[model samples]
Target: MERYVDGFVLPVPTEKIDAYREMAAEAGKLWIEHGALEYFEGVGDDMESDMDGMPVRTFPEIAESSDDESAVFAFIVFESREHRDEVNAKVMDDPAMDPERPSEEMPFESGRMAYGGFRSLVSYEK
Candidate 1:
């Protein structure tokens, strides 16, 4: 089973898109170099509510009325949670993961950035 580091980022504002993209790109490379199998990112999209009042989507909806106009979703896959943690430790110590010296102008204030890790439970592939 594969493990993944999932990031749900709500940008501080639309102006931060460029900076956020740069940060993600740089982080992607570092993760890959540290043994991540894959790294990917995407912008959030609006979705319609389902009959049961649930949103029909794989990703979360971006909050309206937010100072930030967009959200960035990203993840890196690893063979297992153990491998994921190992690579994460390396990334943290790589001198490239400094939050203070971000590669680009961050969209949200650094203190607001949010993230978490997840393990594959059930997967359906074509």
Candidate 2:
């Protein structure tokens, strides 16, 4: 199967995780409603790594999260880049995604978030 994905990494205040989760859940529904194949929001549980001698950074280190913040890694799946674009366009147009939503209501700083689109290299399904 071929697939495209939009991924994100961000830091969310630990005290605001619940609020973040609530917002993310609603957004996930919107994505799905607009034709996303899958919408996933993951809050870090085991973000640290003992890579031993390997030279690599952990999610927390990469996101520059503080002791009072947690790293969030999320992704949305689509059948293709075009499909992703279509779904995202619809989602963007949805009233629930209105830009008027106050930034303060979000649990994380939008400027600090990282996002990207990727084409599938390998995909499998059971």
Candidate 3:
């Protein structure tokens, strides 16, 4: 039973890229120091795919499609849900968490920025 912190980020306007990048980098470092297992960032590009029929892929695919600048995604794995919750609480309460703020010039609506805590229902890896 592994716990993870998943985040979905949409970029700010072109003019704000530098500011956003700096913010995200600082945020990643803070999360790591606060107990995050891993942090990763990626940029989105245009692509064609049919996502209407697949609920699992719909959101991510659409996110990539519409993302002209970048979208940051991160995952932090914990030994158990309880531990995850504990670490998350500490992380949230830490003053360092404030540095990850999204810029005012964000291209997408703030409501669109999504985040969640997830437990591994099943996994296959080699």
- Measured against the true structure, the TM-scores of the candidates, in listed sequence, are 0.73, 0.95, 0.62
**What TM value does model 3 have?**
0.62
Question: Which of the two candidates, 1 or 2, achieves a greater TM-score against the reference?
Answer: 2
Could you give candidate 3's per-residue lDDT for residues 6-124 as a string of tens digits? 65655345455576668668767766776777677654443335567763543345344343545544456665667667777887898876656655544445565666677778865
Instruction: Compare candidates 1 and 3 on TM-score and give the better one.
Output: 1
Candidate 1 residue runs with Cα over 4 Å from true position: 47-68, 99-105
Winning candidate number (TM-score) = 2
Q: Better model by lDDT, 1 or 2?
A: 2
Alpha carbon deviation, residue 80, candidate 1 (Å): 1.1
Runs in model 2 deviating more than 4 A are none
Give the per-residue lDDT of model 2 (tens digit) for 1-126.
799999999999999999999999999999999999999999999865768878778888878899999999999999999999999999999989879878887789999898999999988899
* Model 3 weakest 10-residue run by lDDT: 58-67
What ordering of candidates by TM-score runs from best to worst?
Answer: 2, 1, 3
Query: What lDDT score is found at residue 54 in candidate 1?
Result: 64
